[model samples]
Target chain A: MFDFFIHVASIACLYGVLALSLNLQAGFTGLVNFGLIALFGCGTYGAALASGMGWHPLLGLPAGIAMAALLGLFYARLGRKLSSDYWGIATLSIAEIIRISITNEQALTGGAQGISGLPLLFAGLKPYDGMARLALYVVVLALVWLFCQRLVKSAFGLSMKLMREEPQLARSLGYDLDRIRRVVMLVSSAIAAFAGFLYAHYLTFVGPDQLVSPETFLIWSMVIIGGVANNRGVIAGAFLMQFAMAYVPFIKDALELPTDFVAAARLIIVGGGLLAFLLWRPKGLFPEKVGGSNGR
Target chain B: MIEAKDIRAGYGDGADILTGISLSADRREIVTILGPNGCGKSTLLKTIAGYVRPRAGSITFGGTDVTAVPIHEKVRHHKVGYVPQTDNVFGTLTVAENILLGARQLAKTEKEKRFAALMDQYPALAGKKTRKASALSGGERQILSLARALIAGPEILLLDEPSAGLSPLMMHEVFDAIGAIRDSEGMCILMVEQNAFEALGIADRAYVLSLGQVAMTAKASDLLEDPAMRKLYLGGEVHAE
Candidate 1:
């Protein structure tokens, strides 16, 4: 029971990083990125390739971040001409294209069977490796939370919110809208990629199935339920929803429900959660403080 | 001072909305642009403001050729202030944030000083410093927008319908405030307006457009007294029904 809870905590912390990344782009920058999983995939594939190449395990970090940043720049370029809704569709399509490409690249990515048996990140810790991994994720989540909080409170953050709410006004005020989008996409993608690196290492596997549209929507549910623009709200959201998801199997077992119920629960959690919050709490669990930057 | 010569502009391969429009406004005066809907009043203002580049003319601000400069460059380098007709204030920003959005380049002391002075100038916004702009009334939003432009201490102010969608009393008050800016600050204010009588009342000069062409240009007083002009553009079914 103790080990199971630790495993769940580690996964939850991993998701907290992803939720923070998505909220920073979609909530504050009005990016509406629907291909978050693809950015995460960049990290996973980076690590998997590094492991397969017999490179140093730590080398994967920068490799993964670089690929994600390049994809981020591509996404930002798409945004310069496309409106938010169209840009969302474009991102979703790009993610699908990437997944398909990886699936067909049998020699490079081991086809759909995937690459596994990745070395653990903290082999040096030995007997306490699991706990060490969880601790590292927790520390990472804290750092990301602090970083996001600091970002949103700064003048640049104000410019981001301005771009989100009133983009034309932001441009009129001398902000390079395209440049802001690029920076936000780059940072958010790098963060999402970091989560992917952790996920790949901890699970010892990389597969296209993990980079699906639904996984991105799951993160959206977390952001919607936690808070849209609030950094702490997203982290809290990630943990709560991740635990809810992690416990679904237990619910199935306790209720003696069919195995398919586990799959159905994902749809319910994402779609129903989004609908409920958008209807009742449009701003999410913790709406940004009423007085704008002054409240912070 | 701002001047445009024979400006022709449109958007995204569309028909030229502004054709051969020439106008100028100098310091200590308010120049009003008036026309019927689809006659390109807003387009003309936008062209001069650099939101739309003129295809066949030149724009000079304080003796610099700024025709190709974008709106942001014109604003940051040339000290231009613009207020759109509607949805002008940043709803999510606090009143103070909205006012200070463009003054990021100002010195800290100067920014704060101007902010305090603006608050005193617009007492309706003074009490709502920390309040989000979304909560303000329409008239207050208009005033807040004006205050935002004024805080920059602009050399040229471009206003698109300062009294748009306001009660007659509020309209009069907005025009009075604009007129005060010209009289006191000697700022060259060029505005596009639909409320012909009120706009002309405060403006020193007026340019009337018809079908993207300059239909007339005259002193505001002369245009106001021209009965045929009021009937054709401001009164009767042409404007009312």
Candidate 2:
């Protein structure tokens, strides 16, 4: 049970980082990034490819970040020509393309089987590796939270909210929409890639299955159920959802239900939670602090 | 000073909305463009403000050819301020934050000073500096938009239908505020307005556009007194008071 809690906490921390990344782009910037998982896959693939080449998994860090940055830039370039809804579709298509390529590229990515046998992030610690990894995730999540908090509170953040809510108003005020999109995408993508890198090591595997559309929806649900633009709420939502997911099987067994019910339970939890929040509390657990003169 | 010569522009691949429009306004002057609906009034203001690149003409502002400068560049480096007809204020932000967004590029001290000055100039907004822009009434919102543009200390101001959707009383207040901007800041003001009488009352000159062309250009006072102007635009109702 102790081990299960650690696992849940670790996974929750990792997804929290992802939720924060999405919050910056989707929540604050009003960018609908349906390809957010593609950005994460960049890091996983980078690490897998590096390990496949007999290099240290650590080397994949920079490579993955760079790949995510380039992808983000491309996404921003695409956004210049497309509005938000169309851009969302475009991103989803690109992510699907990336997933298909991973599935079909047998030689490079081990095809559908994926690349396994990657070492744990703290494997050197043997019996203590789980705790160490969890500790590292906690520290990382804290740092990311602080960094994002600082970013959202800055003048740039105000402009981001402005652009999100009133794009023409922001443009008329001399904000370069393309530049803002690029900056936001680059930063969010890099953060997502880092989370992916951590996740790949945590699982010791890189697979196309990990880059599914449902994963993106999962994070979106967390953002929505927690709070759209509120980081603390998003992270809390991450933990709440993660814990609920990690224990669905336990609930199924304890209830003497068929194993198939676990999957249905998860769907109900995520979808029902999202629907509940959207209907009753659209702003989520901790609503974004806006308009207070003190917001500055 | 700002000028557009023989400007032709339209929305993406459409026929030119503005055809052969020539206009200019100097500092300390308000030049309002009055026209019937779909006469390309807003498009003309957009073109001069760099939102639309002129298809076949030149634009110069403050002695520089700004024909190709984008809207953001015009507002940032060239000290241009623009207020659109609708959705002018950032609805989710405080009045002070909305104003400060316009002054983001300024030095901190200068930004604060300009904000303070705007607060002084618009006391109605001063009490609600921390209030969200969405809470403002229509007249207050128009005033807030003006305050936002003014906070930037722009030299070239472009307004699209400044009096749209306002009560008659609020319309006059907005126009008066605009006239005050010209009187106090010495900025060149170019406005597109449906309220011809109220606009010409404060404007130094006026241009009446008809089907993408300037039908007439005259001194504001002259246009106000011209019987032809009344018959064409003002419903030919009461004589210009």
The digit string of per-residue lDDT tens for model 1 on B65-143 reads 9999988888888999989888898887789988998688899999999999988888889999889899998888888
The 10 consecutive residues of candidate 2 chain A with the worst lDDT sum are A287-296
Per-model TM-score, in order, reads 0.95, 0.96
Model 1 docking tier (incorrect/acceptable/medium/high):
medium
Q: Give interface RMSD, every candidate, in order.
A: 1.9, 1.7
Superposed model 2: Cα runs more than 4 Å off: A292-296, B238-241
Give a tens-digit lDDT track for model 2, residues A88-161.
99999999999999899999999999999887887889788899999999999999999898888886777678
**CA lDDT scores, all candidates in order:** 0.89, 0.90
- Per-residue lDDT over A1-296 for candidate 1, one digit per residue giving the tens place of the 0 to 100 score: 78888899999999999999998999888899999999999999889989999999877889999999999999999997799999999999999999999998898898788899888878788778889999999999999988888888887887788788777776677777888899999999999999999999999999999998899999999998999988888888888898888899999999999999998996788788899999999888887663365324
DockQ of each: 0.59, 0.74
Q: Which residue pairs in candidate 1 have backbone atoms (N, alpha carbon, C) closer than 3 angstroms, thus clashing?
A: none
Among these predicted structures, which one has the highest lDDT? 2
